[model samples]
Target: MLRVHFTAEDLARVRVAPGPDPMWEILLSLHVLRQRSAAPVFGPWRTAVRATLPDDTRWLLQLAPPVGYSPDFLTPTAGSCPVDAGIEQVLSTPVASLRADLAQLDCPRPDPRTDLLAGGDTAALTALGDALHAYHRHALVPIWDEVRAVVDADRAVRARSFLDHGCEGVLAALHPTISWTRPVLSIESRFPQRDVHLHGQGLVLVPSYFCRERPIMLRDPSRAPVLVYPIARDVRLTCAGRRSLEALLGRTRAAALEVIAGGCTTTELARRLGISAASASAHASVLRDAGLAVARRHRNSVLHTASALGVALLA
Candidate 1:
């Protein structure tokens, strides 16, 4: 363990939520870069992208470069195999041939947009986007499977390296408290002592790339588990149950309930719905008080499950 000082309050604040600070976003971007560089294939890449940090920090900053500047900007020299060659090869192979070999196969027809986007024609960007969206929905599963195989093999090596180099502590620090609905990677740490206004432990990971210098770590004098990590980026989005539910129970509260679908921790619910953890907790509290949701403690986290009332309302 690299002896980094953190208090109990620091640890307590690390619940996952939506709408992460700026630093968390940066770390996610770096992770994305690492993912893209490692696999350049589909399955492992998607799996790596879907991998979540298993810590209790709620906020995550998602780093995204300008829309089109991702793997394209990081292309290697000519003659090098394209990162997605394996996916392309599989996708290009005759569907009947693939179905004959792979059991439980249900291949869809190829969309033109993927080919157009691959070609990078300015005139075809719109059509390509539409096609890519369709392709992503249909073809992503198989492609991700292929990418995952490569990514997993690489991760095994990296995991070994991480374990050997006393990097597990660092890895632990990077573990997220909550999982995001979208694919993301993020950093985590405590806040500065001066800004410790929140009652409970509070952790923050902003976008890493945006921070020119490392952030100051905030520790509670009371020796609480509060910490901070200067991250790269996090993802944020508003979530709601279906619109009908919203109409029945006012949008604000309905949106809160929608995000709690799988019995999420209060912080997780907040993060998924892109609201403050406090707000999420308050909303959940109201729902619980009304017998719309029930809170249960699992390990150290408090998770909320939809009650009969909630189920009926949502239904």
Candidate 2:
């Protein structure tokens, strides 16, 4: 059990990452590569990557175990950071911090790889960086387009939950294993039990594509506080799902209906569809007439929601 202490102001500061962090994806994907058999969600990815696990990528295996602590240097505090930005942050880490972070990973036996990083060997560091880049490009890029779509969908739902029910609502729906009790938010880490006293820094909630059930957090609290949790494992615009959606509604209309399922304003729908508000409104009108969605006036904005028919169509 992990207890996270929070202040009143902390709740106000709570935020979800607007997008997936590339570095976090790399770190999590490494774990998936090592332990693909453990989670059914990664089965497809595992088969795909097995075809070509480059020899250079093995360097990453030394640090990323199927089950264990991850080096802090690989995970930066920023909500949205490019792969290079994160790699540069790791390279710039103080030798003391690197060694300290590596100390936690000395469990099964002290890994010799730690020495190279601890001693500030630029060659080893550069090689690690290169490995990460190659691994991400080879393994992740192919699926990234769909991956981003899944992540965006998750964020869309989370954002709606935040708007409708506030921070508590967001936390309530984050994951089944996580629970919030006012001042303290408890997470069933299922790891060695400990308490995280935020003191007041609040928490940054990040949604990850490759993360599994148990939520992940920064090992060093002295740094920025963050909790990286898994996005919906089954959420994806698969060829089957896409075809089904299109079958129920035409291709272009299916796209519009899919976005409407998340409950968006006309302006939001327009922006998402890359069409004028008038055009978006016209589509919404069609969906409304077909009993697939309902548009309700809320203040100055019209919010569109998927009706039961729409829900059944998607399900």
Candidate 3:
């Protein structure tokens, strides 16, 4: 479990990135490109893009393997800039930071390019930037439309969640593998267990169409914390999916479903709906019994989230 500890200030500053970060998409997509079974969602994309990747991707592949550490400088600005601007940021990495980042590589293959990069060779840095630009052109630009569409749809869902339930709701609804419990948000990852302390520099949640089942975070803690989570796949949304609240679940019960869809504590549900706590509990009980909602005990409260069926109903 990777636990991110948040201070009060950190909690207040938590936010979703406005849109996809091209650099993040490029880095994580490398992982998918190198995998044989890149999950069902990405298998087809991988098949199509693999044949077109530039031969010199090793400039980045040497650092960003199929799995494990990638230099933090590669994604210096997260969602702050476009690919061209982001590439410049990578090229401008401070010499000290570059050397320190390169030294931490795990089992890096014997490559003179890695040595040149660690020594802050301007030519090597330009080459690295060129490799990134080439890879993005060949692999990401063609599928960029599909990537943006999925990420935007995911953001819409999260935006509704934030409006309904605030930051906690947005955190809780991030991913199934992620859990938000007051001051701590835990994520299941393939990396070794660790904790991140966000004293004041809040976390940036970047939704990536290429991020796989497990969320990815920077290995170095000193840099601004970023959690790149996978966007929902093939979420079937239709006008017919939005049925009248009074029809099947009744007015109040359906209202409860809507609130829970964004995720909230029982007390929060009661407060939002202007109902007594007991009433909220009873409605939640009925919903849980019918598999419309699911609850998890966290600390002293039970956090409720709409189940897949409940989300489908609210679609």
Candidate 4:
């Protein structure tokens, strides 16, 4: 069990990532590649990426084992940073931080690459940057649109949760395995028991397309506190799926769905669809029942939004 202790200030500081963190996607994807048991959701993705594995990318696997410590420098302590900015941070990691992070790896035998990285060799850092760029280009760029779509949808859900119940609500709904109990958030993990206290540093909730099973945290508690959790899987958009959805929901209701994709209250939806408020609510109910939309009560108003699956189906 992993426990994250938070202060009142920390709770106020908690916020979700604006979008997918490219470096984190790369690191977690590498960890996924090392796994023997394949998640049904990622099977197709893994198969596609594996077919084009580049030799240079293998070096990352040595550092980021499937179930062990990965260097903290690989994932910089920034929220929703671009791939280039993230890579630059990794390359510019101070020698002390690099050496300290690498030393924590529980490797049984010494490796030359690890030694060179620990010594802060400029060539080694350059190679690491190149590998990151190459792997991202080969393994992630092709499927990035899908990844971004899924993350955006997940963020939508979280944003609603936050609006409805504040930071606690968002944390409560993060994952089934994670429990938020007032001052502490507990996460079940395969590693030994540990605890992290966010002394007003807060926690950044990062939604990941490649993270699987449970949420992941930086091994070093001293680094910026982040919880990278898996987003809803199976977000593939197709014209056929949209056509089928429209056929099933009919034309006017389908239009309601399209409006809901941007998020709105019942009054806003009724105004946009030029329908009675009751009719708009009824259409939203139908869409919600079909698992295409979610309705959350925010005090006196109920806000409606397209679900991740719903957004994917539409597009």
Candidate 5:
């Protein structure tokens, strides 16, 4: 069990990332590629993108072992950071810190890139950056649409939970592998069990589409404490599923729900669904009453969103 110790101040400061981290997606996708069997949530992605992996992914494979440390700089303190910022941080790492972090990995002596990083070798760093960019392009970008949908769906669900049940409820129900007990949160980890004390820096709970079964955290945990965990649901939306949705919820209502899932005003929904404003209002009312959609009025316009229940059923 990996236990996270938090203070009252930390509780007050807790935050969850609004979306998936591009850096983490790149790193964790490498882990998925290396495996033949991943969790059900990643199966479709793995199958879709496996053949597209570049041969030169060793740049990532070097650090991301199946079971070992990857450089901590690769996993930033901010739960949501741009890819360039993360890459720069890794490249600018002090020589001592770079080597020290890599030393924890279960790899052989002297990671060749460590020397290049330590020496501030610009040419080697560019090659490294290029390698990452190349890997992401071939492996992740193709399936990024799927990735975004999963992360967005997860965020929507969690936001609903927060609204319905408050902070404690959200934490308590984050994942089946996680247990919340007052100021401490525990997660089952494949790594050697450890305890992390958050010295009042609070914690960022980041939902990840590619983070596998276990919840991951910074080894040092002294700065920007974060816990990256898998999101809810295993089944993803498929073309076949979309085609069958009309069967499940009728053609017009299904179309309305589909548009509503991405968020739309009733007028927008009606126009998109090719129906009158009154027809759109009726469909919206039915969905809302069924607990499958929500509509909130802003001035004269009404915005409709698929409820968590709605998204789950559609998925």
Candidate 6:
């Protein structure tokens, strides 16, 4: 894992000011760098690329928008989104073209074991690297600049509010490296840390940071393992107990628990089930009272994770 260092002041500035969009800027950078570096050695490993960054463009778009803003801004019809429909079309064409170009490039031919490795192959590798760099410099950078200009203009105020709310200090403590798809911001205090994960549809803001020092393996064989950090601590800030849970969990608390095996915030659960946040909270209360789930405080929100009993009951 590569560590990117930053001072506390830099962290604070990023928290307040609009920084690079992680999904488009950071993750994409990593993607290009990986392809340039690893493709020569590994022989064009597409799965490795997908593992690090999922193939879902919409998911990536969700994560790429500016910090503190809703993913709704990226929706095509919504004027709220930074990219206009016309601009989106323009930006997408080059990306599609690049993908096609890369796909057409020659990889290890069939029966490579029988073929002799040529010294001249280095030229081909060098050419690919130069092409990738040129694409990044010309196509990607321009599009990114356009996107950032619009997003930053709209979100400047909200970004400042986040900074005022101690986001800078939180980011300083966490010192997370920026990425395109993984837009992260945190606020740490003695009680719990607040973390926000920005996606295309919406932002998932956890009230407490979950400190998982080790990397967690994902069930998806195609995806890379994600390092689990404390994104939230006690989630009770949004849903404290049975009453609060009741306000959230809704009628089918048992079924919901089954779906959200890991845990989910009231907002996330409500959105997923097409219910209101208040209703979701109510459902959670019943589950909590029935000893099916546990609610804890993270930072400003509450998160509910299934208890072993809850899982067994669902089972």
Candidate 2 vs candidate 6: the TM-score winner is: 2
Which has the better TM-score: candidate 2, or candidate 3? 2
In angstroms, give how far residue 288 of model 5 lies from its true place.
Answer: 17
Q: Which scores higher on TM-score, 1 or 3? A: 3
Compare the candidates by lDDT and give the number of the best one. Answer: 4
Clashes of 6: 52
| Residue pairs whose backbone atoms clash in candidate 3 | none
lDDT of 4 by residue, 1-315 (tens): 999999999999998999889999999899888786755767877888888789887788788777878889999955688899899999999999999999998777656777898999988888889999999999999877667756766776678778778899889889878998999999999999998999999989999988888998998776899999987554433333454455445888889999989988899999999999999998887776666776655447676777666778799
Clashes of each: 81, 0, 0, 0, 0, 52
Q: Write candidate 1's Cα lDDT for 1-315 as tens digits.
A: 112433445444443222222222222333443344424322343354346422211111111232211221111111113224423432443434323322221224323433343455444444423333333333233333322222222223233334544333333534344222211222232322232333444443322222212332222233322233333222111124455334437677888777664567778898888889898888887766555565644335565666545666689
Give the per-residue lDDT digits (tens) of candidate 5, residues 2-91. Answer: 999988888878888876788888878778867776745567667766666566666677778766677776676467776677777767
- The lowest-lDDT stretch of 10 consecutive residues in candidate 2 is 236-245
TM-score of 2: 0.78
lDDT, candidate 2, 109-135, per-residue tens: 545555788777787788778887898
Q: Is candidate 1 or candidate 4 better by lDDT?
A: 4
Better of 1 and 4 by TM-score: 4
Give the runs in model 2 whose Cα sits over 4 Å from its true position.
107-112, 240-315
Q: Which 10 consecutive residues of model 5 have the lowest summed lDDT?
A: 235-244
Residue 99's C-alpha lDDT in candidate 4?
A: 95
Badly placed stretches (over 4 Å) of model 6 are: 1-251
| Each prediction's whole-model lDDT (CA) | 0.38, 0.76, 0.78, 0.83, 0.73, 0.37
Give the TM-score comparing model 4 with the true structure, all chains together: 0.81
Candidate 3 residue-wise lDDT, 1-315, digit = tens:
899998999989887888789999988888887777785767767887777667887566667777777778888875636999989988888899999988877754647888888889988887898899999998888766556644654666676577768898888878889898888999997777899999899888898877878787887777888889987665322122334322336788889989988778889999999999999998887776665666655437676777656777799
Give the range where candidate 4 is weakest over 10 consecutive residues by summed lDDT.
234-243
TM-scores, one per candidate: 0.23, 0.78, 0.73, 0.81, 0.75, 0.25
Model 6 C-alpha lDDT per residue in residues 1-315, reported as the tens digit of each score: 322233444333342223323222322333333343434422332344435442323223222222222221111121122223323432333333333333332343422211211222434334423433443343344344333322332233233335555553333333233232223433222323233322222212111111122111112222211222222122221224566445444556656776555567788888887888998887777666655566654347665666545556567
Error of 1 at 117 (Å): 77
Best-fitting candidate, scored by TM-score: 4
